[model samples]
Target: MSNVKDVIVKLTDVEKEFDGVKVVKKLNLEVRKGEFLTLLGPSGCGKTTTLRMIAGFSNVTSGEIELEGRNVADLKPNERDVNTVFQSYALFPHMNVEDNIAFGLVEKKVPKAEIKERVAEMIKLVQLEGLEKRRPAQMSGGQKQRVAIARALINRPKVLLLDEPLGALDLKLRKQMQLELKHLQQKLGITFIYVTHDQEEALTMSDRIAVMNDGVMEQIGTPDEVYNRPKTKFVAGFVGESNILESYVTQVDEDLLHISLESGKALLHAPGFKNEEMIYICVRPENLLLSETKKEHFSIRGRIVEHVFAGSVIKTVVELINGQKLRVARHPNEEEFEVGTYVYVYWHPKKAIIVHTVEEQIYNVIEGTTNRIYEQLGEKYSPSAREDSHDQ
Candidate 1:
């Protein structure tokens, strides 16, 4: 857990609706002072709606939003001490870089000398010093984005909201701006609440991430926490590449669970599983290793189906005897295995995470059983709960 002494913004039971259709539902979040928190999800996941609610652009249907300890739900966008940088840049076409950056201060009736000084400082902060006289038509995509960012930061708002500001840039420029924005946030010590559908961007720049699906928050944690220890199945599939396997709990001994897969039985180290309970086992591609022979505890036989040569790693797809396919990632320097080669897919028992097997499913396997992990153990078996046991 992080040592969050002060919360700059908080959303409690926040909800939104459009034409009687619910978009954002019962969202609870905390943004710590000077922390970079990102709301990440795919399109129509309500990430933008959440950001808009925070920025006071969209009114909440119910619940409370507090900024710096004051309820800001009733405040207008400008009344709240926050600025937004949209994906479109939103810069004036006729105005040059300095004028566009100074426009906000001018609207606030700031003194002439102070506005000039602040504008100059912001220009240098965003590395736009040399492009002061360049119009939006003359500057590159990167420069125009810097100008948008400078314009927003000139007022020194308590929090900054960015709605996919890098979406319009080319791939190379977007990558460059991700690092630049992170460095600028650290230097300024301003709280940032960013919204993006790009998983890589969220993983690359966020101090923490709140992953949402269909207007509900799936999980919120550090980048490593969300990526490595996802609480829900949606997060596991959305954040990164995961090979999920369906299995039933056959036996349990302390923290070790004996699960029966379609191909065979395997032992996994996890908690909150009862006998005959059905669950999904999530394993990252990088965690699966290829071996010539099967291991004692956590191994399965599979036949190589395809091999993709990614620049830094080779992604190998293997089909199990049960007709389920799993992806394994290996370093590029490792010896390659050809298609149709028989091999054993193995991973450490601790590398697998057990998820609740729900209905409405048509992917990997059928729902065979159920255990009241949550109802029986209360919060102890909640989705956010994690087992401390590891392979010894």
Candidate 2:
């Protein structure tokens, strides 16, 4: 973990617009020095736009992009202490590896001896010593990526912005590069801001992840926190494979809440919820368990509809009485049941993630009046909102 006092890059209420449409909205992020922060989302989620604004490739309509406490709102790409590596290894086709990596120094009119020394160091750093004379056309995808990353780092910028730099490589090479990039970032202690639409990629390379959706930053936290304890339904669904159930609150105790799902009910440790209110809870497939016998207050009856063999684990799909489906990941040693087997689905109470969905979003929205809004969700405006406020 990077020290809290070592913030190298900070974005405050950043907003960007294309024509009349807002693309990046109210984005606030603090990137610690040496932290590998990844912007992760589906396409058109403004992740690339956010990266461009930080790189000065795209202008922001409003916000403060600060580097080491200095605002960079009007700074040009070359002027800022930052460099970007794009998905396409944008190298000069005719130039050799040495020239390509030394372009920045050459443009800055550095002395020939210094440029030669720095270029040699970079070539050694990327393990391209013998390939210095080779052109991009003669190198592999991974090699060209190393060249691009080397060029981007030659200037020793305070931060590096990567817009899916490994996107063009094959799956095997991409996975390898993820480790290599992470190793390089840690070895150099450079703050890296990466943008990608791949969930697994973000989880693999990121020290922290910022989940974006429809131009808004949905959630930002360590990979484990974001995956295991998502505060919003969007984050829970987008970050990984999740089994979210639509249910109603039936009982609320000191630190436990009972929820009902169709003909089934389960108890969770989520507190501060009103009885009879609608909610959504998320459970990862690995956490979900299936059994032949039902356990009171924990298991829900469901029929096994299908089994998907996915190499590491077999995902068994169960259809509930209300037509909702749930999945349980079976270990290799576990017995595989027939497709039509009737089983009970349950998990540990602490594993359930109470996520805010449309029902929760409507609480803050007062259409005609606050009373009408509360009544619509069958809520009585209880003090539960105070607990939800802490999540915000």
Candidate 3:
């Protein structure tokens, strides 16, 4: 865990509303200095909205956005000590890379000599040594992106806001740029708040990831923690390929949970839960093994529906008796298990990651079996009073 005092950017219950519709809920986040923090989620999940609010492009509906303990939520874009880089690589089409990078300094009316010196340093930092004369039209996608980054870094802002800056690059070049950007962040020791929907990119480039869904932050942690120990079903499904199983807890003893799985019962050692709770548990594809011979403590018989071979590994999709799909990933082997063959899916007891969340309230809402909502609203659910048309 990072020290709280090292925080460079903080958002406390920050919100955004457009046309009376809330896009970003009350979100609280702390970005440590010099760390690459990526806000990762699907489209329209309010990640870009969050970034815009931080960059002062979008105003916060309520709460505070602090930089170095000073609230700048209502500051203008130029008034804040931060810069933004977009996916479009919004560079001047007429200006060369050198002029584009020196735009900030020129606007500030800095000395020409100092501007030239700083632009040179920026070019070297982004490794655009001889491409200074190349314009946006003359440069490739990768080069233009570097130029844009160079322009943003020229100002030396306390935090750099990159909104899917690599979204326009090709796959090979995107992979290469991911490494370059990570290295650059490390070399400069500057705070980076990145936004991307690509999970692999987020895992590769981010020191920490904030997983968002439906305008709400689901989970925020390191890559391993977010991937391995997801706190919610949304995080589990979004972070990577996972097989989520719905189970009902029938008994709980300390850290041990006895759950009713499928038509059978199983014992899980995950801590924290209540009896009769409908919970979600997940396991990664690699953790699950498909075998013909069943010799395990826990195994579910399933039929192979499809197999995908992607060079390094083979993905086998299995359909269980309950119609739920499960996937298993492993290196290529000499196993001749064709599609439609029956196999057993099994994993160690501890491989299951029990999703711990407040979703029980949602389940209550769905089932319409709880009076908690009425209690909160200072009322009681007395359906029986209306059971007989105002009579006994």
Best by TM-score: 2
lDDT per residue, candidate 3, 1-392, as tens digits? 55768988999999899999999988999999889999999999999999989898888999899988888956899988899999998999999999999999999999999999999999989889998888899989999999999999999999999999999999999999999999999999999999999999999999999999889998899999999999888888889999888888888888877777683355567875689988788989988877798743455778899989978989889898778888888788747578999887777768888874546535645646444443445533454333343585
Q: Give the TM-score of candidate 1.
A: 0.89
* Model 2 bad stretches (over 4 Å): 1-5, 358-392
Quantify how close model 1 is to the true structure by its C-alpha RMSD in Å. 6.3
TM-score, one value per model: 0.89, 0.90, 0.88
Per-residue CA lDDT of model 1 for 211-288, tens digit only, reads 998998878999999988887788888899998888888989988898889877788889756889788889999998
Task: Supply every candidate's count of residue pairs whose N, Cα or C atoms clash at under 3 angstroms.
Answer: 0, 0, 0
Q: Which stretches in model 1 have alpha-carbon errors above 4 Å?
A: 1-5, 357-392
Clashing pairs in 1: none
Arranged by TM-score with the best first, the candidates are 2, 1, 3
Residue 221's lDDT within candidate 3 is 94
Candidate-wise lDDT, in order: 0.88, 0.88, 0.87
